[model samples]
Target: MPNTASALELDAYLRLSRASLGEWLAAIRKISGCRDMACRLHNGGGPVGALSALESEQGFIVCIYASQGMDLTGCRTSDPVVLVPLGGEPQIARQGGRWQPLGKLIVARPEDRFHLRLPELGRVMIMRPRTDILNNLVNSNAGLPIAECHELIDCYLRRSLFFRDHNHARQMTSELFCRLGRIAREESKSGCDCSGLDRRLLRAVDKIRHEPDWDFNLTELASYAGVSERNLYYLMKRDAGITPYRLYQRNRLTRVRYRLVDCQCMVPHISRYAADEGFSHLGRFAALYREHFGELPSETAQWRRNLLEAESGHSEEPLAAP
Candidate 1:
C-alpha cells in the first residue's frame, strides 16, 4: 500500500483481496453509518494481502486479520490502531520501545510508529475515521472538544482491541460508532458549550496523573474544584463516562501498569505504590489489579522484568527461585 493512500483507497484494496480474514467489513458498515460500504477477498496467498480503508465522516474503517509468523513494517498510520492477541503471541516494536509481547487490548496511538513480528498465529484490528462525517461532526469549534474527542477515540480503540468474538465485537463496535455519530450530530446542531466543564474535568485528571501518590477523596477533590460533590460526580460522569472513584482507580492502575511493564518494579513493592495511591488494603489492591489487568500484580512485575531484559539485549534469566 502507498504511504499516502486514502482510507477509502485502502478499503477498496481490502474488498478486492481474498486474504482478508475475520468479520470486520460488515461490522464497519453497520456501526460507522457508511451507506456505500463494500469488501472483496483475494485468497491468492504468499502473506495475506494488506487491507486498508479510506477516511470518512460517518465512521472509521477497521481491519482484522489472523496471520502466522510474518514480519510487518510500516504498520504505522495517522490514526490509532487497537491490537489484541486473539491467539498466540507477537512482538511489537514502536518508537524507541522494543518488541514487547502483544497483550490483550493494546491501544497503539498515532504518535508511535509500529512494526510487528507474529511469533505464532495472531489476530489484529486496525480502525480509522470516516473523514467526511467526522469533519462534519467536528465542523464547529464547540461541537466536540478536542481533548474529549481524543478520549472518546482512545476509548473506542480500547474497546475494539478487547473484542473477543465476531458477533459481540461487531455489536459493540456498531454501538460505539453510532453513539459517536450521534454526539457529532447533536454538537453540530446544538452549538453547545462545554469548555468550563471540560477544563474542570481535565484539571481533575491532571491532578490524578501527577499526584498518584496523593490520597484523593471525592470531598477533597470537590473542594479543589470548588463544586459540590454532587455536581462533581455529574461532571465527571458526563465528561469521562465513569464515576470519580473509578476514574481515580483507572488513573492509578495506569500508573501501576507502566511501572510494572516499563520500570520493572518488584511485586511486593507494588503494594507500596498502591498504598501511596490510597489503597488501604493489600488484598483489595491485588484483587483490583488482577481484575483490571487480567493478571496478578506479581505476574505483571515479572513480565516487566522479562520484557526489559529482552529489550536490553540480555540473556533471559529465570526469576530468583521463587
Candidate 2:
C-alpha cells in the first residue's frame, strides 16, 4: 500500500472546486445513492469549496467534502455507510429526530434518513464498503481508534489504485479483515452490541421499514417473521419496547412525514401525503403524526414551504418605503 499522495494519482479520483450547493448535492447523490437529496446554504455566500470522491475496485467508495456552512437532507444509501468528520462542527439527525454531535466514526444504517448540518469550512469523510464489511461493522460496533482506521483507509486507497505489488495489497486486505474479526470478538465481550434482536424479528422489521404502506396485522407479520403471534409480540416488546403494530405505525408515519417535508415534492398537501402512506382517516392521521413527530402533518408541509421560500430569497411581507 502506498501513501495518500500516490493513491491520489488513481484514475477513479474525482475532484470539484468552487461548486454550488446544488452541484455538491448532485455529486453526493451519485456517490451515496441517496434519494430526494437537498441542501440549504447557511453561510449567505456561496458554499464555494472542494469535494472529491475515490472509488476502489473492491467496492469501497470514499467521499471527502469541504465546504461553507449548509444543511443537507437525504435518504441513506441502500447499504450502510461510515461517516467521519475531519474538521468543524457537524450534527446529524435521523427521521427528523434530535440532532446529535457528528464528529465521530458513526454507522448510518440503510433504513434511516439523515439530516446533516455542516458548519463553515467543514470537512467530512463518508465511506461505503462492501456489504459483508459493513454488516460486520454494524454488528460489532468496532469503536476502532481513529488513527488505526485512518491508516487502514490510506492503505485500502493505495490498494485500489494498484499502487503497490499485488502480494502486498492482498496482505493489507487480509490484515484489515483479521483486525475487524478481533475487534468483533472484543466488542462482544464488552457487551457493545447493537440490535441484539432475533434474526426473525430483524426480518420482520426490515419488511416493515421497506414497505411501510402495507397494513400488516399481527398474525401476518408473525407469519412473515416465521414466529408465532405470541412470540412475536414478546420479541417486539423486549427488543424495541414497542408493539409490532406500533413499529409498523411508526414507519408509516415516517413515510408520510418524508413525503410531506420533501423539498422536491410538487404537491405538499397533508391529506394526499397521508393517504399515500395508507392513512385514510385525516383526523386520526393528524393525531398520529403529531404524537409521533411532535407536529401536525400540516406543520411539516408548512415548514418545507417556508424553507423553500427562504432559499429562493422571497418573502410575503410587504416592503417598506426606501
**TM-scores, each model vs. reference:** 0.41, 0.46
How far off is residue 106 in model 2, in Å? 0.9
* Candidate 1 C-alpha lDDT tens digits along 140-228: 34544444444454465433322322333345545555555555565422223333446666667667656756776888888777778
* Alpha carbon lDDT of each predicted model: 0.49, 0.59
Candidate 1 regions with alpha-carbon error over 4 angstroms: 1-197, 265-268, 309-322
The lDDT of model 1 is 0.49
What's the CA error at residue 117 for candidate 1, in Å? Answer: 18
Clashes of each: 25, 0
lDDT, model 1, position 156: 51
Best by TM-score: 2
44 in model 1: Cα distance from truth in Å?
A: 40
Candidate 2, 1-322: lDDT as tens digits: 1112111222123233445565455546655667577777776666445444444333444444445677778757788787777667788898779989886777788677887877766766676666666676777654555555555554444333322222333444455544544454454222222334588988787787666457778888899999999999898777655678776776677666545534344456778777877889999988877665445766655544543443455755322110
